[model samples]
Each structure stands twice: as C-alpha cells, then as structure tokens.
Target: MTPTPADKPPSQALFSTIAARYDRCNHLFSLGIDRYWRKQLAQTLVLKADDAVLDICCGTGDMALSVLIHTPVHCVWGIDCSETMIQLAQEKRIRRAGRGRLRGKTLRLSVQDAAALAFEPGMFAAVTCAFGLRNIPDRARVLAAVFRVLAPGGQVGICEFSLPRFGLLRSVYWAYLSRVMPMAGRVVIGDAEPLRYLARSIDHWHKTVRLEEELAGAGFVDCHCRLLTGGIVTLTVARKPGPLAAQPFL
Candidate 1:
C-alpha cells in the first residue's frame, strides 16, 4: 500500500484504523533501525530485577518487551492511547509464549493516554517511552505525570527520532524520512499521512538540549541526551532524586 498524504488522522480514530499495520510500516520504513534505537534506550536504562517499570505510549509493546527480555524489571506495564494498539500488544504477548516466564517478568498492556495516566504516585522504579513523545500534544504534562509516578532514584528513558544538525546528514535524513518514507508507506501500507505526520512532528520537537532541560524542570536529576544515527534519533536518560517527597496527588 502506498500512502497518500491524506491517510493520516486528524483525530485518534483514524490512527486506530491503521494500528494493526503500524509496526509493519515502521520496520519497513526505518529499515529495521528502529529496533536498534529502542534497544539502545533500554540498555541505557540499566534496569534491575526488582524494578517496577512503566512504558508510556507503548505502541504494540516492542520497547516494553525489550525491557522484559534484557532488564531485571519484575513487571512491565505498557500503556497506549490506541485500544487497537493495546490489543495487538496483547496478541504479541501471547505469541511470545514462554519468554516472559523464562525471564521471570510479567507484561501488562492497557489503553491509557500518556497525559492522563492512571497510576499511583511513586509507583514505578523506571519509565520509558520510545518514539512516542512527539505524537503527544502536551508532552510537559506527560513528563510531570511520569515524574509523579516514579519512585525516588528511579530513572526515565526516552528514545525518539530527531533532526540532524549537520546540513548534509540532516538533508539525507529529511529526504529519507519526509520523502522516501511516505512513498514507501503508500506502496507498502497504502497510507502516507501517518508517516508524513511523523516527519512533521520530529521536525517540530524540542531541541535535544532543550528537552533535557524540560526533564529537569519536571524534577528529574542528572538528565542527559545522546544522539544516535547522526542525530536522527535521541536517547535521553534522567533520574528521580532520592528522598522521595509526598506527591500532591497521593
């Protein structure tokens, strides 16, 4: 299916319609680099077995599953805005068969919006979001919610696509993401606007340094960001300070 520019949704409903194929298009369009980027983010997290993890905007749960496999996190709770995406994530969980058991970890998925999470304060030891923040309209609120839900000394990891700074590499990245990806989406999934929006959002996102400051503003400490693929993607890690304060919501 080749995507036309009109294939993207103005609201959430249209996005749900293509949820089933989103993963497929993502891998194809990114040439499988997406998984590596996610793996990098998960690795940077350095999760321990006792950690309670939350994956926001989990989208089919690839990053969450990665954490379940490589990290010692006791449980991974995945949340996504799209119910269809959650359904697909659950199906993937079933397909994994005994992988969860082998690691002694559990995977949970639910349809939840990032801006309005249903979690108790200081409940998660770690939180992650890969390639999901840009789609959100209110990222600051989401980050604050993430801060509220994380336990002291907890870490947050974010993996997201970003524009390159170097002119030549940025040009190539833009050509591939903005031009080639939409064409591929049209041919592969018969949709285009979703990828188009993806490109647009990446362009519209905060600069890496600015984003790290946003994390600090949300009460995270030792915030940092690493550029991947010539700045085509960014992996951010931040930690909650020790000596937990009572959450106002709690």
Candidate 2:
C-alpha cells in the first residue's frame, strides 16, 4: 500500500456505495462489450516474463486479471480509492489464487488514489486504467503519477468511454442514455445517478486527439489512440521513453 487513500473522494465514494452491483450494471449496460474493451486494453501492455504491472483505479480487477491471464507478467498490483471496490477485488483475487489461474504470479490490492501512487519511481513495467479515468477529475495528475511509477519503456493503456458522434448512432446513444439507461440502472441497481454521471463524463471528456496531446504533455512518448465500437470507446496507449528508444535508432 503506497501513500494510500485516507479519505475517499466523493465520486469514488459513490462507486463504493454501488460496488456490490457495479460490475453487474456495467456488463448489463454495455451488453457485455465492456469485457471485450477490457481485453483489448489489456492487450496493449508491453509485458515481459519478469515485468510487473500496476492497474490504477482497478475497480474490480477485471483489467488487472486480464493482464495476468493475457500475459506472462511477473506480477500485478491493482489499486483503487474505493474500499468497497477493493474489498470485492480482494475476494476475487483470493478465489483466483486458489484456482491456479494466478499461475504463481503475484496479484496485490491497495486502496490508493490514481493521482497519488505510493510506489517508487519506475517501479512498474506497465500501467493500465479502464473505464475509470472518466470518474477522475484530475486526469492529468493521474497520468503524471502513472508516468512516475512506470519504468522507462513501460506502456500505459487507458480505455475510456467517449460520447458518440456518428449520425444515427449518436441519436440512438443519447436517447438510450436519457431514457433507457436510467430506467435500467434504477431497475437493476436501485440507482440511476451513477449511470447519469458516467454518461455526463463521457459527454464532457476530452476527445481522442486532445487526450493524446495531454498524454504526450505528461511525458508519455509514442502516444496512440484507437477508437472502438463505433467511436464510443477509446483505447489510448503511450510508451515511456527508455533505454530501447535511446539506443541509436536502428
């Protein structure tokens, strides 16, 4: 646990309140596409057998688990500011541990803020965040923090929702958000406020180009953004310059 969160921010705290049902709601709303987005995001990591990974705002460890299963990484650390979320992660981690799915790789959990990590400089080989950046207000700070802990040559994969912009899809998406989504959330989770925030965040979030610029400004080189599922979701991958990049470009 590195410089962990003593106080949960309001948005994260709201996540805590819904932690028990959060995963279910997400899967339902995304029609299970969230799983595919997470898989694609996890595939962006530059993992080595001896490399360690950090998943900030890991929520329920979905992406972190993906990293573990998708690559032969040395270990994984999944952190979040919401205790309830972390608690759920712990349970899942324990179950996976007993099932041998961990493959002898370490998976640690911490209740830490994404903007303020506890690990030392260049402590991780890679870092990834999925669907969590939209909830974070200080995304720049979190990016900087990710840059700090990631080793040179390490990569960061960020998967986030963006508002739809295409013609008919945009209209249908907005209508779903305004009407069907809230009704689904309320019916399934007894709350629609969180879903509302999720929609609003996407509506106001930085578009792909702006997000890439922000990542580059934070010292992440080789930044790239890929749109998925009709541009409603974006997967951004950036590399931290390191020994390989400096070795006299062949």
Tell me the TM-score of model 1. Answer: 0.89
lDDT of each: 0.80, 0.79
Per-model TM-score versus the true fold: 0.89, 0.89
Candidate 2 is scored at a TM of 0.89
What lDDT is reached at residue 126 by model 2? 84
User: Which digits, one per residue and each the tens of the lDDT, describe model 2 over residues 148-230?
Assistant: 99888888888988766688997798778756897888899898877666655566664323778888889888777778888
lDDT of 1 by residue, 148-231 (tens): 899888888998878888999988878988899888888877888777877766766733236787888888887778889888
Steric collisions counted per model: 12, 1
Worst 10 residues of 1 by lDDT: 1-10
- lDDT, residue 245, model 2: 28
